[model samples]
Target: MTAGFEAIEYSSRDGIAVVRLNRPAQRNALDLTMRGEIGRAVEAIRDDASIRVLLLIGSGGSFCAGGDLKALTERERGALANRDRIRRLHLWFSELLNLEKPVVAAVDGPAFGAGLNLALAADFVLASPRARFCAVFARIGLVPDLGGFFLLPRIVGLQKARELIFTARVVGAEEAQRLGIVTEIHSEETLEPAAMAWCRRLLEAPTGTIGMAKNILNQSFNLDQRALAELEAYAQAVAMETADHRTRVGDFLAKKPLRYDWEALGRAEDGQ
Candidate 1:
């Protein structure tokens, strides 16, 4: 476990890593230290091949409430500190966006501002039935940062994104799902478990294939239809070349159900 997380808590289970923002008092409002640690952890995921999935969660009822406003107001720093804070936020997010493995967010409560965007960064999100998301930046006379502008519009369309950011409106989990923000909603008690379950299923999938798909999906943002079609063909060709895919295809061609050995995974990726 990392230290001083009075702001966050982290633990590992099976092959899944859980990162919990633990500061209920201030809603896990991020500061410099928390951001640095989280950025480190996120980037570290790539090197830990034993782990195939990651769960980003929170303690108390708040995932995170953006940067701790109270902490900011109390700080006595030159403009440099403010710039550094914003830069740190971007660094953490870049770490998130660059992660190679599947990431699942199990959101149990409110995720606002940077918090909501963090949830959005995951490959998919599962929220508690009562969970709420908001773009509260405008509400407090702040502009959205931390990739919100780049990600939100693509998830919900330009018009809906504008309303969300401009009005600072809150959306429930169901509406979030409708807007393609969340993939499912679980009972509060099962939110984290369900997210992990989903992550485990993802781990069983072909690792190289998922990584390639993610790369292609990220590039879909800038590609034309023809280019997208070409990429799809290329992706399918590459996915068919993986060891997992070859094994499964052999089973399929032989009309047998493919089986995997759990013990084999630890030996698969660079012998982690």
Candidate 2:
């Protein structure tokens, strides 16, 4: 259990941490208080070593409706003040992004604007058929923020991303899947189970190796071959020394079942 959180529900089970945005009355909008809660929740997860994977979901039906527009308009701030505010947001956003553990987003209703970007930050996005995603910034006379400009183009490519951002199109789950924005689609009823199952699969993986690989791969496109090769060398060297690497190798030589042996998983499925 995580304490002192009002905007989100936090719990852990079987090495999985479930963080659910809890303000359904407001559609779980990203107001100042909710933002602060998120930052605290992220830090708690960061400091806990027992939690292996993070499952990010929303309470009630809606995932998030973006920033609290009402709150924004209510506050009269100067340019520097607004800029500082966004910078403050990035502080926690960067921490969440750089978390070494796997993150799975279980999305069910509307994920618009910053909400959409929030889902994108996850390593895997599990969307329900009813899920609606929109960039929605153009309609509000705002450019994409919250790493949208960077993440969207990479996932769906430049042309399609431009089309979505410029037109402020509302994308359904099916179309989002085709465009590679969504990793998988499940029924609304099964979304949580699916996300949890996916988290279990990730939990079986060697965490250190996966984290290092993810770190390198995230930067692969930006780095030149030489730079990437250097990173790969360093990461592989570190990976080679992990207990998981040694165990898997030893298991193979001894004909013992490896943790992630596909044949083993297949046999288990068949038995089930």
Candidate 3:
């Protein structure tokens, strides 16, 4: 299935929904129209239970260059108007951040400013060898947006995040992996396939269980131990009562192969 839009392409198949930024001419730069289309795509994913994972990618080789500076400059708005515009962005961005299903970003080239933040929003970032990331807001005398304030410091340490933001330096794929930002680096030819493989692995897991765990984990930094314990207890209790858990237990008792085994999958993929 596909959802038609001008600035983005939304499609789903075999439980994976893809949101591809389509403005290749502008390096998939974010504009008001693209942002709105992304929001709509996200909404579609949220409303569809058949969609188990989201694959975020870009067209024309580049992931995204950042916001469209030309568009921003074409119209001058008051401080209040600017603030409102950003606030509107949060309406969709917040949902994307808290989305229950797994999100994988396959970045092939530059992901700058808001582009970088968009990739950070994903649970796993799969990058090509030539991929580059930059917190480029400082270059334009602006601050990071699109959940950068929340996601960047969490991925990299606060000090490193500060340095990246302050310097606006471009980070190559290898450096990004070292910083624990890029989950995996593949050759350009294999980036998309790797991302799809990851999604396939995730699809083997019990979606409800993973979603519950993800929900609780996303709040670990904010909640106290007591609060987290309560949440964990609740989530685990719910998970234990699920049919998927019962089926897995039955399989275990019957000495049958488990449906989801990460290590086994890895070994098979490695031809071990």
lDDT of 1 at 109: 78
TM-score of 3: 0.97
Model 3 lDDT on a 0 to 1 scale: 0.93
What TM-score would each prediction reach against the true structure? 0.86, 0.95, 0.97
The runs of at least 3 residues in candidate 2 whose Cα sits more than 4 Å from the true structure, single-residue gaps closed, are: 261-271
Q: How close to the true structure is residue 106 of candidate 1, measured as C-alpha lDDT?
A: 85
Per-model C-alpha RMSD = 5.6, 1.7, 1.3
Q: Relative to the unseen true structure, what is the C-alpha lDDT of residue 103 in candidate 2, on a scale of 0 to 100?
A: 94
Q: How many backbone clashes does candidate 3 have?
A: 0
lDDT of each residue in 1-272, candidate 2, tens digit only: 77888888988888899989999998888999888988888898888878889999998998988998999999799989998998899899887877888999999999999999999889999999999999999999999988898789989999999999999999999998898878999999999988987887777778878888878877887999999999999999998998889998998899987787545654564465
Residue 84 lDDT, candidate 1, scale 0-100: 80
lDDT of all predictions: 0.80, 0.88, 0.93
